[model samples]
Target: MGKEIDSTITFQNLSQKNMSFEQVFQHIITFMKKDPSGNFRLMFGTDSQVFNHYTKFITGIVIQQERKGVWACIRKVTVPRQMLNLHERISYETTLTEEVVSMFTKDHKEQLINIVIPHIYKGANFTIEGHIDIGSGKKNKTRVFVKEMVSRLESIGLKPKIKPESFVASSYANRFTK
Candidate 1:
């Protein structure tokens, strides 16, 4: 077997203790079950902060319960700096989001549960939105790759969110990376 990648995740409201991905998923299910209305959105996003010799990557999951409230979980990892260009950084961020979504969706499919989002008139039981850090603006150099990133996400069947709308990445996760 391949060597495991060491990592830890902490839920903002749950506890500071480290948790595996499975444990995090269980918590999400419990949170969703608490409200029979089932109107909630699960959003995942990732952001990175480059230091002198290393880069810190933060991946955040935000669960919004239709204005009831919000809960978030975050995982952080650090790696030696690679001096990645803007394109590489954006690509890496998207890859991280995709990995987390893939894990959640795979399990969600096996253990099907009906999630009712009142606003969503039709389709799947729930939706996972991927918040990309790249956005269109004069100050943001990452804007150039927004279309490519969005297209990649769409090809994999994930709804993409950018800047202003992608607070999970630009706001929530960005906080911890700092």
Candidate 2:
């Protein structure tokens, strides 16, 4: 049922004009046959960015048919920090100045997360430093990467978080898949 309704609506209609990302989102929920009827949702990014770009992240959405409407949304799950860490961590170098590391140790962190993924709301947030745990698989690959990302985020006066970013990413992923 959900699939059938979704098939009838072109993704473009959900995000073609200057409608704020929220407006387009509303159209999607409404057209998809919402029971409670909520055609308005707002996110802090472009609809195209959030949607239309999930394959890049290797994620997908799964829509579960509710008794009368669609689900809240769910996506292929993974480690919040792992996902935000980005593959770039694989080639990161760990040579932070003692002063820089010390400064950060005293400050908070930011995290980068993927928001609405599969459906077309490919979202990402960068705050709360994603604690990188270089698994025993590699030498110092992950260690270096985490150090680099932290330095980069600090350079921009930002921090990293894992929870929010992960939640957003999975939510979008589920929506896109649906």
Candidate 3:
């Protein structure tokens, strides 16, 4: 948000927009791939608690677990084509831990968070960065790639256990661009 005379130049919220769910999921997956160091554990939860909580939360909504365990949980979540948020995003990467990680992941349980995280970042424009790929390419084509991947998943009847709800304007994560 920026001040422009009496009014402020604001970033638009596209949460209620029309879009594909695949693109959103892809972003999250890409980010997870970058989690080679395990720092991402903070984003989801302590160890595997996020997965368990995810199953419990969406149990009756998108899934009905025949059996449950600690290793993994089968649950359903909304995978929208796109989304938008109108709040200020907070810096929460290394600072995150088990407690808040559990809450954020659960709180925004419905969105395809981290799906396209490789591209939609907080400081993408102001930095030189390292050898980045995928997200930095033709961004408009982002949706095309995502949908194709989703089509493949659907073909295998593989539900990722995570889904995001779409909107009319921007394609966002579970809630804020966390």
Candidate 4:
């Protein structure tokens, strides 16, 4: 048989545990179905922290309804050794975010978009974004990488967001990295 995705790979939030990606998508669908006319934003972002011997990375997936709240979950991955290099860690974080975004194939995106298509004229919208932990602020060490990393996210069809605007990475995922 062809290689299959590991069942052990799961995303979790406060109320759920060990949920597969498909399960998470179903939850997103159910949430959207409840208010199809609302504008929505699906965002994914990753942040990492280096412990003594290993590095921890957490990626957050958030679905937000404008003027409404959000339903979010996170997936964690660990590297065997600490990653001290700034560029490498940032790149890896972006890669992790890309991997999660890739899971939503064209058809999956279409399904989400369809839910709001009919209400588009009424101001309903569905947008997907990739949040990078780096920023372009002069005082930021990650400033040098802003161009390259943002370009990388753009290549994958995401509206790239960074630093302060990237709360999913800087705030949500960062919280669990510690």
Number of the predicted model whose TM-score against the real structure is largest: 4
Clashes of 1: 0
Write the residue-wise lDDT of candidate 2 on 1-178 in tens digits: 1112222222222325233323433543443333222222211110011123232221211122223333222112122333223344222211111212222222111110122222233231122222222332345443434455455545644332222343323344334433
User: Over the stretch 35-152, how does candidate 3's per-residue lDDT look in tens digits?
Assistant: 3222221112111112212311111111111122111111223223221211101111101211222222322333333332444453221110010001213543333334443343
From the highest lDDT down, the ranking of the candidates is 4, 1, 2, 3
The candidate, 2 or 4, that scores higher on TM-score is 4
Residue 14 miss distance in model 3 (angstroms):
7.4
Name the candidate, 1 or 2, with the larger TM-score value: 1
lDDT of 2: 0.28
In terms of lDDT, which candidate is strongest?
A: 4
User: How well is each residue in 1-178 modelled by candidate 4, as lDDT tens digits?
Assistant: 3334567789999999899989999989988888999989999999999999999999999999989889999999999998999999999999999988888888789999999999998888999999999888889999999999999999999999998899999999999999
Residue 176 lDDT (model 4): 94
The reply for model 2, stretches above 4 Å from the true place, is 1-144, 163-166, 169-178
Q: Model 2 misses residue 105 by how many Å?
A: 27
Candidate 3 similarity to native, TM-score: 0.17
- The order of the candidates by TM-score, greatest first, is 4, 1, 2, 3
The alpha-carbon lDDT assigned to residue 34 of candidate 3 equals 46
Q: What is the Å distance of residue 2 in model 4 from its true position?
A: 12
The list of candidate 4 runs beyond 4 A from truth reads 1-6
List candidate 3 segments past 4 Å from native. 1-18, 41-178
In terms of lDDT, model 4 sits at 0.93
Assess each prediction's global lDDT (C-alpha) against the native: 0.76, 0.28, 0.22, 0.93
